[model samples]
Target chain A: MMDSLAAVLYLILFPGFVFLLVFGLFCEWVDRKVYARLQNRVGPPLFQPFADLIKLLGKEDIIPKNVDSILFQYTPLIAFAAVMTPIIFIPIWSATALFPLQGDLIIALYLLSIPALALFVIGWSSVSLYPLLGGFRAATMLFGYEVPFILACLSCGIIAGSWRISDITAYLEMYPASMLIVIPGFVIALLALEAKLERTPFDIPQAETEIVGGVLTEYSGKKLAVMRLMDDIRMVVGSSLIAAVFLGGFIVSYGSISWAGTDLTNVINFLLYIAKSLMIVFLLAVIRTLFARIRIDQMLDFSWKYLAMGGIFQLFIAVMYIGILHG
Target chain B: MDLLKWARMKSPWICHFNTGGCNACDIEVVAVLTPRFDVERFGVLLKGSPRHADVLVVTGPVTQQSEARLKRVYEQMAEPKFVLAVGVCTCSGGVFHGCYNARGGVDTVIPVDVYIGGCPPRPSEIIDGVVHVLNKIAGGGLAEKSSVNEGQAVQ
Candidate 1:
């Protein structure tokens, strides 16, 4: 009973709700700062995201007359919960996750996809024109990206010889040199993940310039705040998943650097994990800032043509390499 | 309550609404968002949806066709919203005053919190106007007026 209680507390406090929320907002600030510097403009202060959240929360929650009240009001919370669930299974400070399971990688993938599904539901339930269009676009983008994203993950699983994320991390720790071979698949997956997060170049679903806030057009007040926070958390989840799979999941014991003793390794590893994920988030922001939003057809064509083909090629290479080595 | 007010003041997302005049004031409003002026430094984002906006930066004199839309947009915004009427046209219809189909100014449609007057106000003036609105939000300028309006409506 004590163990279960402790697990619940850990899930809600340390590596779970509070930690992810704060770290996610920190990552958002870093992204905004880098984006502003890239554009040669003075950006928001460090607490800008937090301030925005507070203001949104303080605003009056408005529900339009044409909408399904129940679904429209509840989906943001569902989306936020969906994104938060995966953080528990991701090994942040150590090889073993707080809620480790044998096939949690597949579970994490499904959980990660829930936010997009929830978004579709939110848009559909609104019964508004822009949101309906945004819902259709989000669904189409999902179809375009999910195939390549899965193939990329499958390639990593094949190379590491395990579907369990903890096992993959262990294998990578044993053979750190294999990260070079995994880079191609990682790059393909990273681009797909960026589209999944709905950033620029692939932000067809929420093209604010054309669709007028897209799926989020009808959301206001606390719902909007929750949605924005969910997006930020999703960014952290995507980056952390990529970092765990490809960058050797929180193994901060670099050669000959024994400055910290064993007791402090957990804290150091946690910071290292956050740093690695922030680096990925920064790269994503730089890519987003450098590119303009692409048309839906152009986005579909690029994803289906280049990214899908690249993912398959990477998968094929991984299969051949693994078969030869095992045989 | 104080923290909420501070947060609202710190990050004021503005939604630009053009009623019916020439495109000059609209262009200037967009210029404030450009890299040169970059109102984002003050945490000002040009929100696409009225639902997400905290401040409505209105341009142009109200036309008969757009007057209702302007009111609807203002009503759609969340509470604690402020309206900044930009350009002389939005303030008092400018040269379009007394023209057929002109509704004079934004205040004829919805209450305005700040007035920025120029044929087409420069981006700097627009920025100053936004800062003034931020002050009003922080210093309770609108609070007193809203209370008075509430009392009058009750009577």
Candidate 2:
């Protein structure tokens, strides 16, 4: 009964959350397409990521003779499930989410963190020197990116006057201009998330060529497949969270779905959430094509120096916003 | 066009070996995959292990220290593999050609099929050279036309 209830709520939070479950392929497709065009070369058809996933899945699971069987098998699911948990707490539209409990911002923030912990576990449990280094890099990255991300979230909370996501939307409704004011804050938050996502210009922790897919090097077959999908869903969830928090979550009531005079506002909200998430995913992919991965020092310097500076300045702006509005 | 289509579909997987050159070419080789110049669309991909590769893309001027790693990678690659010496440093060891640490031209270590002939050839030219190797594999111009050169290139 609880499982069924959760299913209905998941459907309610965003009609398109399932779409994000498949979003990694979309990001992959976008990266391939954009990169191809950048070189004046023809890019792959948009469905390339889907093709790759199927191929990877169909591959035989190969375990090295000396490997730890249990950790090797379970690591990918941990990565996927840990990342997916945050999706349940994030509101897609006004007063809507997979679980719709209040204080969701707190819940969502903590849930968003588990994937990093899981990644470290995977890296360490594999018992390889390269992944161990990659895992350490992942831990270092967590320390560098999370502070600025939390501050950016706090600035939004300051603007909205509550830790609740629903309240953030309501504050935006009361003063739609609050959306415009949070621009710098939103950008810093997005970059910090990008760094966490480990896209190029910030992919120092898992340099594939140098470390052989980093923490994922020994992961193969079903395990590797799940981990890859987790990455895709992570992008989806991250993008959706950004939209819910800053881009007017579920504010648009696109033609309603009604049953017996009760409007399924939840369903409408879901579509809105998906649309917003896809836009962010597309922008990320397009940006990915144009940039190369930066060195480790450069990545750390970028987050600590520019991205962090932007977050601090934006926090200052948020303070001035409260002064002007309430004072 | 038929020949080009076949060449495109069977684009050989490239294995990169650093023979002790500075990391500039190494970075450019990787830059080939960034959103700007995706080589994967052409069916060219990098293989981490040499055993699975069809072509060996050698960078650097073949320093004595790196020579052992390079030779190991070359020996691991399957038969009929093409050797592409990228950058002037690999072909004729540019500035570092005369350095005591430099072995001068990758050919001093392994037989080179095509020399890309640039400080660092544009990714497009790298693609060109890579595709050229595929052509030779399929019995194209150089394979059909050049000397069945038997001299050990290292000498």
Cα lDDT tens digits, model 1, A242-314, are: 8888887348543423454546667767877888898899889898998999988898899999999999999
Taken over the whole model, the C-alpha lDDT of each candidate is 0.87, 0.71
Tens-digit lDDT track for model 2 on B74-113? 7655544678888999888788856877776877777789
Q: Output the worst ten-in-a-row residue range by lDDT, candidate 1 chain A.
A: A253-262
Docking class of 2: incorrect
Candidate 2: deviation at residue A111, Å?
A: 2.4
**Which CAPRI level is candidate 1?**
high
Which stretches of candidate 2 lie above 4 Å from their native place? A1-18, A93-95, A253-271, B1-39, B42-44, B47-155
